[model samples]
Target: MEAQQKIREQPVDLAILDIMMPGMDGLQLLKSIRGSHHFPVLFLSAKSQDHDKILGLELGADDYIAKPFNPLEVVARVNALLRRVHHFDVPAPPPEPEAKQLVLGALTLDLKECVLYVSGEPVMLTSTEYKILKLMMEEPGRVFTRKRIYEAVWEDFYMYEDNSIMVHISNIREKIERDSKKPEYLKTIRGLGYKINAPAEN
Candidate 1:
């Protein structure tokens, strides 16, 4: 608890914890942190079982390195994961369509934070709204079919529907745009689907 509190108070870029901690144990700590915070965690464990790796990964740990692992290798993997996640922290600008936020002029989509900002105002969104936005925001102006959007948000592919997507989009636009009907941020592509316009690539 002390270590975790310190981590929460300070800006911890990453946390390297041994699976066998003195008091709380690694898995419990990982679960707790994952539930409350979104910090990257690298698990160090002597258990080389595939099950162990799967458990750690399933628990939202950033990396699961076997004990006696090379420090250089661990650092490289951690750095790589950070680069991939951090570099794509914001929405991406699309080159194909006018739906790009970059093209639309001024909209901030913080992908990591799952936040939408228009002229510094916070545009509230739900989990579904944020996921859909993140997918389209990654490539603004790109027309994503309902199937694609469904797959992006939902795990079960067969049960996907367009209505849910539309509803989420409506909810999202209501929060972000001055006029939900004639949206500025989230826009429809007629026969196609929804797009966000240059969102946040970098």
Candidate 2:
């Protein structure tokens, strides 16, 4: 309660939470803060199980670091998360004059505003989800294997983290696809990976 109150009072750029806290667990704190805040949250927990990590991500945590983590690695992850959320890193120049708005079927992605619109209505997406969608939209019709997607968007080495990629993809589909089961734009290539259909000139 006291901690939450302090957080509410101060403007914070990021939050580092521990899962095993006395009285109220970190997950509970996360649930309470998430409603009003959109800042990045990282879980530093001893509960290093895969399910635990998945649960944290599902609950809107930006990243999870297990106990016994190297301090330098933790710092690196934190820096990466901050850079991603703040869009501080410079990207390579595009091949052509990038379109301000990318349209594919009913979906419209505003590259300048970093927002997604479905049928003229805005849709919310997490930073990770937006990054994935942006990558696909940038090069529609290009088959991006899971490894390539993870490496490109995460800017981290791909260690076969399938669940993390799959979960984010599922979330993106829920937001943009009229029927997630019968996705129109984002398509999966079995035995390969995924790709977004080429955007039609608007």
Give the number of the best model, judged by lDDT.
Answer: 2
Question: What's the TM-score of each model vs. the native?
Answer: 0.46, 0.78
- Could you tell me the lDDT of residue 166 within candidate 2? 73
Question: Please, what are the lDDT tens digits per residue for candidate 2 over residues 42-81?
Answer: 8999998989888887776777888989999888778766
lDDT tens digits, residue span 90-184, model 1: 34445443332321446676653555677777665434455666677678778887878766554334342324456556666766777788776
Instruction: Please list the residue runs of candidate 2 whose C-alpha ends up more than 4 Å from where it truly belongs after superposition.
Output: 2-11, 22-24, 32-37, 88-99, 160-162, 198-202
Q: Worst ten-residue run, lDDT, model 2?
A: 87-96
lDDT for 30 (candidate 1): 79
User: Candidate 1: which pairs clash?
Assistant: 91-200, 91-201, 92-200, 92-201, 99-197, 100-197, 100-198, 101-197, 101-198, 102-198
Best by TM-score: 2
